[model samples]
Target: MDALLILSGIVVAIIGWLWLVITSLRLPVGKLLLAALLPVLTLFRRDQGYARAPRLLLTAGCLTLLVGLAMLFHLHPHRFEKLVTGQWQPDQNRSQTIDGEIMGQRFRPERVFWRGDDLVLEEGPSERVRRSLKIRFAGAGALLDDASIALLPNDPGAWPEVIMQWHVGALESPGLRRVTGQYSLNLDFAPAANSGATLRLHLTLPSQHQTWITGEARLDQTPAWLEQVRQQQSRSTAVRERTATAPRQSGERPVARWQAISVLAVLDEPSVVGDAAVRVTTVSGRAHEGRFKGVTDEGRIVLAQAHGPNQVDLQFHPVDIRLLETFQSPR
Candidate 1:
């Protein structure tokens, strides 16, 4: 519908300009160019003679109206495209971000990340109009006319399909606040743990006249992916710091880098240090690769499990401990 409207508008504009040029070419070529290109100037050129002046003025008025009408359409929001259906599937690792689907067919998202409880998804829509139209501007007085609607979709009809920009995570719900990045969209709600392993997201059209899309994804690996995203952010920060101070250490050897590690534990449960990738060994030749939380108090070592957000204080003793080695950062 949008394409048809634009195509027809262009055709009409071209025909109108051509007709004006041929019909009024009896005047000097320079005057004809001025009248056609800058119709408003024709209004001031009454000296061109009253013979064709009124007709030319009338032509200028009509042309001005036509241009203004086109501008009005361009400035307002209009439909862009029609979505078939949408779906999402987990990546090969079954964690991190998932692949997108259109009408049960596989597709891809431009970018994906986790921000707090919401999973962010982003995809660039094929532009029906020029890219510059998406940018909004502001200025004093008439300059404001050059501005655009910030929330307006580049393709008006597919506005609902632009999940990232619109934050359309649920049906008929307000969009969630975007944390960062253009085209990034945050899911309004996270899946409840007991709600089942499969998490379903529904996207409804704001127009309320189009079909809604649903995407079901796995939640089991979401937490792990969230942790990975945080780790990436930490790495990025460190790199930026290194880059900023590069000039000062131009001839020096790179310094050893160490990551901040943490002991993650649930209340009343043993605190786990590192995962399988990292191994911790004791003096007794005992090697452990999983979570192990022991408390040291006075002269005894007490071990227990943990859960939730609570902390436990227990006694611990150093008995024939051999070694405590960590190859990677702890979570």
Candidate 2:
């Protein structure tokens, strides 16, 4: 029934278009094009006799087109909703980002987004990106629930955990699979002049074979309420807390705590220095310029040299530093 109405509508609309064009051929070039667009314009022809049949046919075609569309909506009431909200194509949302591994086949994905609702990661050519990873919240997950994109939990302790469903692999390669397991998002929503944030995506998909969907993606977001979140954070007298996974056994590498790097030194503090470009001269008389990452829990100075997106942290003991100088001229 649906197909029939659609086909009929197509046929009638075309017939009306052709009928108008055929009668306007002898007219001027402008009139010919005008008649093609507005078939009803043919009714104004000085010769009422020639315009009679085409005018009636055009009316019938228009009515058929409207009726067909009406019936289609009646049959599929959700049609209108889908047109407004449904994704017709993978990148149909205009904004797209991808990161992480899809069934261990691992490739590049645009990783420039952050959201708690319908967070999609796309990788590979257009088609496979969506086939790679999808993350969605079963409940309202946002610091500012009304924020543009769901702002990651600002409480520092509030984590949105869910049984996430991910399309782990492609159908042909390694056979398509689904991993349904515990998952959570850890976001560091520090105040910045930019629209991106650092986040850690933790997933337990069982077997640990591609346990995590896609590589760790830097999910960036811009919410109008970000400044509000920053303000609220500023008012609260609490330091952001970090959680360790478990007690480290032996050779297992420790999970790095995802923390915001804030300036530890003001011009007033002449003793300690951090969070800016600086030259560090060691007691061994070796000097290097690097940016400061916060000290590790074990009291090691974390100096980092940034190369594009990656930062290489060179650690040092506080006592070994001979002097520290900032690129800024002293005021």
Candidate 3:
């Protein structure tokens, strides 16, 4: 019945369109003007039963033509070209812009790839240098509720790999959604890999569904970029160290917590330094103050007491961490 109703509507729309075109071409100018205004007069005419059929058809035809035009333009053909072709042909040296409509909203990407879990996009040019942006996805397994991406430092010299958090929904159930708390890229942790080096992203769900996706850089290998950043950091650190070593006339110097943590994480272990410590408060209101040991295999942080003889190791996931603060500059 539904199919039949749809077919009937299509036929009526086609007929109405044809009638409009035929009348516009064949009818005299005076008659064409009268036909266009006849529908408006029908609303006021009380005894007009004979003109009702033509009036209704003309109005319906106009509305259908407007709707058809909207649909044709709204669903842009160029945007879905990559989807239909199943390949991303982007420039090797520079980033490419990929555009599409997802969930009725237009999504444009600085770089593009059809990963296993979702359609991956580099949101901006800054991702090439900073590597600090969430990958947007809207395909396969589930719809994304929210997502955040960050680079986690593994080795001081090596490029930090990508880590992400996604609030995703089940494909089978519309409203049933869960957050993949924190899933880091399960890629080869090599700093010397090329910009186009391939990496894999595996995000597992409570339903035992593991979404694996592939990624590649548009320009500048991870190792090279990090090496350049590290060189600049070293120069900056030297200046800061010189400033610190200089005698102060009156007041004490203040430390920037985040900068200290990042610098220490790159140069040495935060636990090894006497003054370096990070205090992280969890989502459940529990606070843990300790030296930053490192990120675990499961993407959790290893926090150890800075001064205790018998070290207590506390494992906290990225999702659980509410705030992170560093005590002082690295020794």
Worst 10 residues of 2 by lDDT: 146-155
Question: Tens digits of per-residue lDDT for model 2 on 1-331?
Answer: 6546656766876777787789878777888877788766666665633445666777677667677656656544334224437633445443333344544544345544545454555543354333345454433334233111211122222333332223422322224454332332333233334655433343434344453542344445654455565555444313322224346679766554332222334223424554767656556444545776656665656566643443334555567576666665322
lDDT tens per residue, model 3, 1-331: 3233334555665565445445455556665554454534433544533244554674565555555444433443332333346545754554443333223233344554434334344433443211112343322111111111222223111122223322112122221223323433322212224443232233222223233333333323333333454455467558757765777566655534343234324234434444457776656443445676776666666665522223334556567677666665534
Better of 1 and 3 by lDDT: 3
CA-lDDT, candidates in order = 0.36, 0.48, 0.41
Show the lowest summed lDDT stretch of 10 residues, model 3: 139-148
Whole-structure CA lDDT of model 1: 0.36
- What is candidate 3's local distance difference test score? 0.41
Ranking by lDDT: 2, 3, 1
Score every model by TM-score. Answer: 0.28, 0.30, 0.29
User: How does residue 204 of candidate 2 score in lDDT?
Assistant: 35
TM-score of 3: 0.29
Per-candidate clash tally:
24, 8, 0
Candidate 3's displacement at residue 128, Å, is: 19
True lDDT of residue 297, candidate 2: 64
- Candidate 1 to truth, TM: 0.28
Name model 3 segments beyond 4 Å from true: 1-14, 23-26, 30-55, 61-184, 188-217, 220-331
